[model samples]
Target: MAGRRNGHAGRPRVGVLALQGDFREHAEILERLGAEPVEVRRPEDLRGLDGLIIPGGESTAIGNLMVHSGMLDAIRSFFYQGGAVWGTCAGMVLAASATTGPSQPLLGIMSALVERNGFGRQVHSFEADLEVKGFDRPFRGVFIRAPYFEDVGPGVEVLAEIDGRVVAARAGKVLVTAFHPELTDDTRFHEYFLREVCGSDERS
Candidate 1:
């Protein structure tokens, strides 16, 4: 099992899905957080990693690429084997069990119904200070053609919402966020994934 190294003696190895958008941003954040960020473009790239982040991009494009690259099943297997996974924006859409509007490829690990571009189009993009659970204060959420969960299953925990729309959630080792945390200077979200989710306690 590619589970988290809870008692590891060194920095945790984290993988960023580089098949799509904003991966570099995530990698940079991980580096700043004292983690060794690995760019995951193939199944082999997931080996020895404690966690993985699926970055925001075109859902259809990322999904199709995953299918073509054999990453869909690879990631499913990785998660089932106890790997922690976080999805942002379009990445959140890919993690959903079901999505409103046209169907697309999904990881279907999270028991949530999502709506693509729930907030509206690019012109409708906006920002807000979100009250994230367990956070000291508010998190600056940047929504760029983001997706929101219409409903989540009983096992899923709602982490943040705006106007009753679920924008962040977690189910077991999986985390999903509708907004782009990497766009901000705040490293709280990334730190949360590393320490809270991935079980890494190392600090830079």
Candidate 2:
């Protein structure tokens, strides 16, 4: 484990995919939450990570980078070996089994059919208070060119939604959000991923 190797002991070492997007924001959050945040730019960076976070950005660009960097198959193998993952916004698009509109490279780890930019264009971006499952209060969801799930296969648990559209969901150790939580001050989503998904006991 990275924590043990890096002398962090019980702290979980989480990797943030840095190929594109607001990876710095995610890294800051993970660091503030007491976990070691590692920027994963290559397939070899996946080693010893307790979990991975795919940040919000251009899905097609990020997908292309992953393919060229040999990170596609590497991440798949990491996931199958019980690695936890959380995908936000465009990351959700890459994580889904299939997407509407354009054909793009995907991790196909999450069992959901997603509609890219299902909300609208960038100008239509907006925020909403979402009632996320397992949370004591509503979460402020920041939707920027967000995508929504048309459907999720069996075993996938819907976490939050807006206007009856699925905005957040999870299957086993993998979590996905149509909105950006790192953009907001609330760290509940990150905390949940650390404590619940990664099985980390560290309290933020």
Q: Which predicted model would earn the best TM-score?
A: 1
TM-score per prediction, in order, is 0.94, 0.93
- What residue runs in model 2 are displaced by over 4 Å at the alpha carbon? 1-9, 200-204
Query: Per-residue CA lDDT of candidate 1, range 1-204, in tens?
Result: 123554466888889999989999999999998999999999999988888999999999999999999999999998877788899998899999998889889999899999999999999999999999899899999999989999998889899999899999987788899999999999999998987778722211
User: Superposing every Cα of model 2 onto the true structure, what RMSD results?
Assistant: 3.7
Residue-level lDDT of model 2, residues 18-93, one tens digit each, is 9888899999999999998999999999999888999999999989999999998998888777788899998999
Give the TM-score comparing model 2 with the true structure, all chains together: 0.93
Q: What are the runs in model 1 whose C-alpha is more than 4 Å off?
A: 1-3, 200-204
Clashing pairs in 1: none
| Candidate 1 local distance difference test against the native | 0.90
